[model samples]
Target: MLVTGCAGFIGFHTARRLLTEGYQVIGYDNLNDYYDQTLKQDRLHLLTTNPSFHFVKGSLENIELLQHLFTTYKPKIVLHLAAQAGVRYSIENPHAYVQSNITGFMHLIECCQLFNVQHLLYASSSSVYGGNDKIPFCTTDRVDQPISVYAATKRSNELFAYTYSHLHHLRATGLRFFTVYGPWGRPDMALYTFANSILKDEPISLYNNGKMERDFTYIDDVVESIYRLMKKGHLQTRNTLHEIHNIGSNSPVQIEYIVQLIERELNKKAHKRYTPIQPGDVKRTYANLQTLIQAIQYQPTTSIEEGVRHFITWYKQYHNILD
Candidate 1:
């Protein structure tokens, strides 16, 4: 099995889970300074402790490296999770998204097709819904309108995967992940940023006057969904070679409520700064997990409070905070 972005948050956890399941995982990542290179290296260090795990430091844009990976390892299953991931960042650095999510994704799928990869699971985002007024986002919903560059790139990946599946008969699955958060989460994400700000007594910005809501899926649930899909995704019979599913908690919580939870966890009050919503950000995201539940016989069960507690605990330990 080959896992890209093994140094990343979701990629790291997924790679760890796969390694624990007795799979020899060839971990690939560029270890970019997107947020913090130290965090990425720490995650890689943990994965390297596993004898079954092999590390490769390279970017998805390097087709030569990716081709070498596919040619040498001959991974039967390809999990493509490496992408420039930031909605707000995309507004400033659209070129980065185009290069990594578009060009790099093209290289990945091409290698998968050439290598005869049995199953290819890649990440998509709920942002593809694009300010949709619908209650819960579904896979069947029309996602042609993506508001942000990040969302557009994810949608493009789905289309590219579909084209490859049609042309090369490559078994492909696109996972539309919601706001996944937990221990080892990205610092750019709300949970981690909020925690950091609160701990430092800095005012945390609350966009849209804290009116936003999100379906915050836990990391463990996301990993479980991906693993189930990888193991049984081949059995899913469809007219086309491509399939897409929404992996989310199916429960949307308000931004203010999450902040309150974090404050409660740390026993610290936060200085809140109410502001307008940033560009390329959605107001709310709710995922309809009926498709995922039917396919995997499971849905995300971690509640907001529980997930927040887990993240805070990990955060304190990681930062060496004395309680």
Candidate 2:
């Protein structure tokens, strides 16, 4: 099994789970400074302790390196998760998104085809359902419009994967993840940022007057879904092996409510600054997880409060914060 972005939050958790399941896991990560390198290194350190796990540090854009890794490992299953993430950051550096998400992703798919991978699963985002006021975004919904370059690249990935599946007989699955959060989450994400701000008694930025809603799926749930999907692989349809599933909690929570939950978990009140919605930001994201449920019997069991508490516990321990 090969997992890209293995040093990242979702990638780390998935790799650890695979290792525990007794699979020989090869992790690839660039260890970029998009977030804290220390955190990425910490996750990598934990994985290296497991004998079943091996890691390679390199960017996905490095086509030669990616092909070399694929040729050497000959992994049957490839989980492509590495990308230049963050919708807001895409506005500041659009070229990075194209390089990592577009060019890098193409390299991954090409290698998957060359290696004859049994299954290729890549991460997509709910952000692809841009400007759609629909309550719960479904897989069947048309996603032709993307508000951010980051989302556009993800959508492009799906298209490219489809082409590969149709032409090369590659089994491919694109998972449209909602707002996933838990321990060791990304710093730029709202949950982490809110927790850090509340802990420091600093003002937290509330976009769109805190009217945004997100389907905050727990990390464990997301990893479990991925594991199950990986095991099941992809089914052929119309002579093409391609599938798209939305992995989310199927329940959306308001941004303000999440802030309140964090405050309650920390026994404190947050200093908040309500502001207009930023560019490349969406107002709401609700996922229709019926496909995942019907296909794999998957259901997210963690509530927002419980998930937030778990994250808070980890945050305190990881940061050595004493109340």
Tens digit per residue, CA lDDT, model 2, 106-146:
99999999888999999999999998877799999999999
Considering only N, C-alpha and C atoms within 3 Å, which residue pairs clash in candidate 2? none
In candidate 1, stretches whose alpha carbon ends up further than 4 angstroms from where it belongs are 238-240
lDDT of each: 0.93, 0.92
lDDT of 1 by residue, 31-52 (tens): 8888988888889999999999
- Runs in model 2 deviating more than 4 A are 234-240
lDDT of 2: 0.92
Number of the predicted model whose lDDT against the real structure is largest: 1
What TM-score quantifies how close candidate 2 is to the native fold? Answer: 0.98
Local error of candidate 1 at 164, Å?
0.7
